[model samples]
Target chain A: MSEVATPTQHAALAARVSDACRSAGMVGAPYPGAVAALDTLGYPTTRQERWRYTRVTRLLDVSPTAAAPHTAPPAVVSGLDALRFTFVAGQFVGGDTLDEGANGCFVGPVSVALARYPERLEAWSHSDFATKEWFAALQAAAPQDGVCILVPAGHKLERPVLAHHHMPAGVHVAQPRHLIHIGDNASAEAVLWSDTTAQSEGMMNAAITAAIGDGAHLSLEVVQDEPGTVHHMGHHHFTQGSNSKLTVRTATACAHWLRNDLHILQDGTHADSTFHGCYLPNGQQFVDHHTRIDHAHPDGQSDELYKGLAADKSTAVFNGKIMVHKDAQRIEAYQRNSNLLLGEQAAMYAKPELEIYADDVRCSHGCTTGQFDKEALFYLRSRGMTETAANNLLVQAFLAEVLDGFRPEIRDYVHSVYARRLGWS
Target chain B: MLKIDNLHARIGDTEILKGLSLELGAGEVHAIMGPNGSGKSTLASILAGRDDYEVTEGSITFDGVDLLELDATERAVAGIFLAFQYPVEIPGVSNINFLRTALNSIREQREEAPLSGKDFLAKVKACAQLVELDGKLRDRSVNEGFSGGEKKRNEVFQMAMLEPKLAVLDETDSGLDIDALRIVAHGVNSMRGADRSFLVITHYQRLLDHIVPDFVHVLAGGRIVHSGGKELALELEEKGYDWIVDAQPTEQA
Candidate 1:
């Protein structure tokens, strides 16, 4: 298939997108450069080697109309003792919904942080993926509204900071951006959830740039469950310093189609990174994850495990690569991707690659894609379980290896979501 | 009580059991001893509703219900259990969770309330002890990385938990050490009662020495050529199956 769109169409879409970004107050007001990069990337055609199997042109098919800003809806989540910020139709409506406990951190809006704590925006400018990845750069230049989080040095936030990027009830382009910084010896947890309203239709292209300073610990989770016609394009970039620990989990349960990009750079020695992804897509939905983890210094460690279940003609893709620099001796990197197809039409593609330049480093990658074991199915059924229960048992068990490591609160919530997705609720 | 009449079964056009017939009364245990490829395992599999074997001609009645009409899970709910010779290893399904799910499935069919978590745990611990299964292993995945003996013992452990009306043991004694065999035999013996019937199929008469079936049936070439009491097993063990196979032609004549 040829990606032969007229130049006029590209120029027109770029001009409109750039205008929206400037009107929404892009960080650097560099929409011209973003338009130039978008020209080279050209809307993620399947012709690209990395996107050979993932069909993403359908996401770009929707006409690019700027999402209309609306009044924030009443926040629905409670009981979580975290600073909660909600953006209504890609616009932050100003205050924290949850009761504020003063965690010595900022959670609300990028505009407020840029106006106040300008120091946090410094890390945003140096994102490892923004210049390298087209989607990251586009999101950086075209965010309608977003969240900025900053945890100061030597102080650990006792409460989590939660942000919700809410799209409104109509066809529109939604670009949401987030910048997070954890200073030296600081610790914090954050959650980014994007959901569209009923009858909503559009493309939600979002990006996150996070930096963990020396000796800092951070846990971040990203969840995308949009309603009808909402295609998701997400970019997550992480830069870790010496002795820092960062754990990230991306759980995609519901979406029309999703393409997620994750880039992790271990800039300093002794940094540790863990990436866990669980995707359960059913009934014509698509979920693809492309991740790259780079170990630039000695003693850096990274572990990645991704699990996916495709049912009812759904498709899932996982392409993960871990690279160890020549100087990064003694670094240990491990990656494994496991996929299960529930029906004949359902499909999964898992590709795991390891590039090790250091002779002394330990690195391994494994990819497995298969239907449920027939013997295991028969064994469960022979024990009196109905076919559905047996199938659910096996599916849950296949995913449990990854889910078991999630923190208790996240695990319980994720389990509930998964159960509902399995039609148990 | 269980009865099979004129059973003709085949796997992929190859008949495993040809015109075989057997019966077992309530409160009785029957042992079927046969040489290798004599269809001992096939009979057990057919009784448990394995789909690979096509029952060309047969009538199997279990507890007054037509067993052939039911699927494997339905047969399980109807109180039929088969102990696999090679128990499958399931990595993600925990032993305790699988047992509870299976037990609850059966209970649902019988219109019984599901066992509470506390009660089930108690029952599972007691049953695990019967087969000498380590308490810690119950929390692990079913049969995954278990020793050969442990897999066989796990089968009996699950049997004790399900409490089926009819239990078919197929080569359960295979790959077991003497001590593990003793433990398994003890578990089977503990589950035996007036209402339960068992079909113990083994290549060796040694397992019968422990279970002590009331009747012994010598199967040769897919047919029961001889039937007698427990002494028949010892005689076969001593004289060998060659004597029975050689005498079968003359006995039929």
Candidate 2:
């Protein structure tokens, strides 16, 4: 009856996970300090403020009894004109693996990239989450295959890359680590999508790490559309150099229970970062998005927006923090989180934390949670729209600001997923 | 085409419409003018099946069908349209897209086919022209950042698109300039036909001057205090409602 996992239990879980990864052919040294961090942080519990709304006690039971098959699922956004790669259960299945040697760009599986050019990826492969968060440490300790994109200095990728990881049907576990390093003045676009079948049931603990060099620009779109009973934990981290720009957009189209911890650090002057995310959890599902951004240098700007809705007894949480370092002057940071409760029993928790030490900085944040506008509903109804149609329109309107930021293909796919789940399609 | 007999309704414990009765035949435009707090807007809300008010004693029959039984959406599908006094501003829903959905929804409910994209666009163009609602406003979010006159004109444009049988103008002329008022009345006059009826609820007689209703009824104390021809609007406009409201019976009071 003790849901709180002890230190011994956490050690046993880690040992079992490493063995499972080794058998699954993930043979590489763990990220530095990951094993020790796992031991120190231990498994997260509701007692911790960071894990207050996200209950990881159920995740303790996620020890996969057997490995899931590595068969490839169907392609997503197939019509999208991009270099596509497919992975199943954190193993590369098929796609165009672009390996352009050490000095050139390389877009392929992380395992392949590690074996091909270890020194090239040595500096940026590790993320802060590996030494800070327990789940992230666990993922790094027993990492699996995910897409790895490395662009050399002053180079722009001609085509975007779509890395798709699918979780097949079984009680399995997959900890995939996607890495991206955009060199100075280099630019690239990529989409990291993970999906599962309705019959699929397991855990997908994933991590995404990116390093944007000076004057580099990297745009990323992340879509998590798992419709099964899987519990997903995502650790997404990004670091930007001087004059670099980073744009990250995430759409949680559907999830059973998901928690996304996104952190970004502007390590140099004049770094610009914009991150926007949206989630709609219905039918007793739960979703949490915890985001933090640090403006460590002067003249840096960051804009963060997270909007979502909880419907039909579902619960959603959003906590955003903005940290401006002591010498990070002339920084402009704005964060806003808005949520809608579509059901009487639905719940939404939103909080914004800002810590500033610089005297000449502008930082502001606002969080709001409310129900559907009755006046808007009545207006639509009076215009001849059915209740369902009106509600669908309202939901679409509420999410358009966030969802519209995604690529058209991804935007339509995510919106359709929401419609199908909500019975609007 | 419409009949309200002894309609007694209230929001919470304060009764707004007490013993209100009225009748309107097909093809007739009836204008109801009264002083402030005379249930002019309340009666319009009740006819459109707003859930904010509870009708304790009433019978609203529209074309021999019980209007009270339908929800607001069903009422719209049943050919009832209410031009809100204050139109709700819905962000992110384009005006054209909203009209299309509404038109298609009403058609689907009436067992008709959906409109084709080409035909729908054509309809939008024609309807948007009726109220002088610009092409830019037609593409923007519904009522978002629209001027007061533009919002009122948009309502008439939607009315033109829906082509409802019973149109209730609930203080539609409250916040409109002279030009916008003429445009709104013109749109309403153009839509009038043998199969369509209108219940124009207003506080000013200026709107009636343009639309020229067939009958003018003064609503006071939630009841029909006076009924006359179109000239009654002129009399009330010149003399004000103090003469009519003061003459109401004391039984309800």
Candidate 3:
């Protein structure tokens, strides 16, 4: 993609995407609404209020399906001990880490799922998004290779599943879509991480559509630790069933331009949903998270907390909204966004909003932005810690609110991974 | 042993400690009683190497080393501890983690290997017991949402754990009731030894009744105008600081 690409160029790129789908024999099949949406909505511009903090014109010219850079499969992810489905530069590399899903779980490339379980693949291809979710629609229109994970009803996985994405050298763009469905009474946890050793800076516009059945539980963690030169935009949509539980933690460790949109629908009564995130952006890095929770049924509950740590000319944007439909009575929703600015030029924009139509429901939202406590810093330094150590401890303490939301089994592992990524441990 | 000679410190050109001089001997408990804004806290903070105030002209020597040249952590590793007048609340940093980090850092400063987890936990338990601190508080954030009494006790617990050679108590008795004051005083007294010393700074002489300072110094007008033995605390308490502060100008005139 060329920098300073125009919207008209993106409109042409949208046409190229439609033609690519047609020639690839996916014209009538796959998700047509997404292709239609992309054709109608092109891409966002800074003129829009939500796109003020992010700029995508530089990435608008990525030639969809750029050939994968010739490279070896990454071996570093082998120790994750999950059903690993590796994708490099928008193409599926043969899995040496895992061949097949274990114990009533199905994990494989999306094309394989399309060939084997076409009906289920088609069912989850559509997103429940009404607004112009440009990235999600873009991925759907050009998803050449991705992962599909399914946990059949009445089955529980003993291990967490991991889907790792790596972009090899010289690739300009990669658009991969993922589908995860948890059947009734099923439970599983999955972690997705994206990285790059590639030097040719580009973008990755990925999407994941997850559906949870009645009384099922699913926990998902998305870790973005790409080099600061790369751009990333991701969308995750979750639809829940009655009494089901869903928890998601999105951690943006590093990226030059990172934007994530999480849309959750509590469609069934008594469903519980939790959304927690931590974003640390430093030195020209930009991270944004836009989350919306829709309480569509009575007695549904949703809680969200997102914390940002920005330093050294970086910026963090958070907009979390909870909407209670007119018929969705007895809903309980809470949202909070907190930010800590550690550098002189570091900036943060946080908006936590609540819209309730039900009179008797409990709803609250708050946002806070500030620098680290000077008194706390002195207290730590006076106890024999150097300035760096004290700063590390304070940042860790700031992020502890979101870190405590992970499950017990993955809590320590996640914390260590994040700490290492942040150069704190 | 610590010595302060002709110490003069200020913040933003306003003098706080003006040519103040004092000496602390090993095992000696000295109390510096002064009113608010009289530089009581400023003296303790300066001893702890707080950088907000610049020592305009003075020298502070700790154990025959120039304490003025050392940083805050260096001062801490060199065995100077300051119990803050208003303890800070650090959310999400558990007391256990903070204490463990501090203990290991101190050991590293001393060129000693870190202790095993079991040994460290045992030591922490003993120190908590010494200060009558609850074990549950150990897992909670440092001083976050803690009662005033708990925060003060945590300070003493920290003092017991680090076992500093010189303990500077800055208003350790400010918000304490009679009972808390006694417990805190006992915690401090228990750690007193032939090689350990204390410089207790308080606005009231009541704390000296429990800790029983060996020397009482009257700090007024940014100087120690009077020095006496322990009985002097009662005399100052009865007559109040008015007479002493009142006499400074007349004597100078």
Best by TM-score: 2
Show model 1 residue runs off by greater than 4 Å: A1-6, A15-33, A64-79, A93-104, A123-128, A416-425, B246-253
**DockQ values, each candidate:** 0.72, 0.90, 0.80
TM-score of chain A of 3: 0.89
Candidate 3 local accuracy as lDDT?
0.81
lDDT of 2 by residue, B131-181 (tens): 878999999999999999999999999999999999999999988999899
What CAPRI-style quality would you assign to candidate 2? high
The full ranking of all candidates by DockQ, starting with the best, is 2, 3, 1
Ranked by lDDT, top first? 2, 1, 3
Per-residue CA lDDT of model 3 for A229-252, tens digit only, reads: 667878889999999999999877
User: What is residue A307's positional error in candidate 2, in angstroms?
Assistant: 0.4
Better of 2 and 3 by DockQ: 2
The chain B TM-scores of all candidates, as shown, are: 0.97, 0.98, 0.97
Q: Which stretches of candidate 3 lie above 4 Å from their native place? A: A1-6, A12-30, A61-66, A70-80, A96-104, A129-131, A198-200, A407-425, B250-253
Q: Give stretches of model 2 more than 4 Å off.
A: A1-3
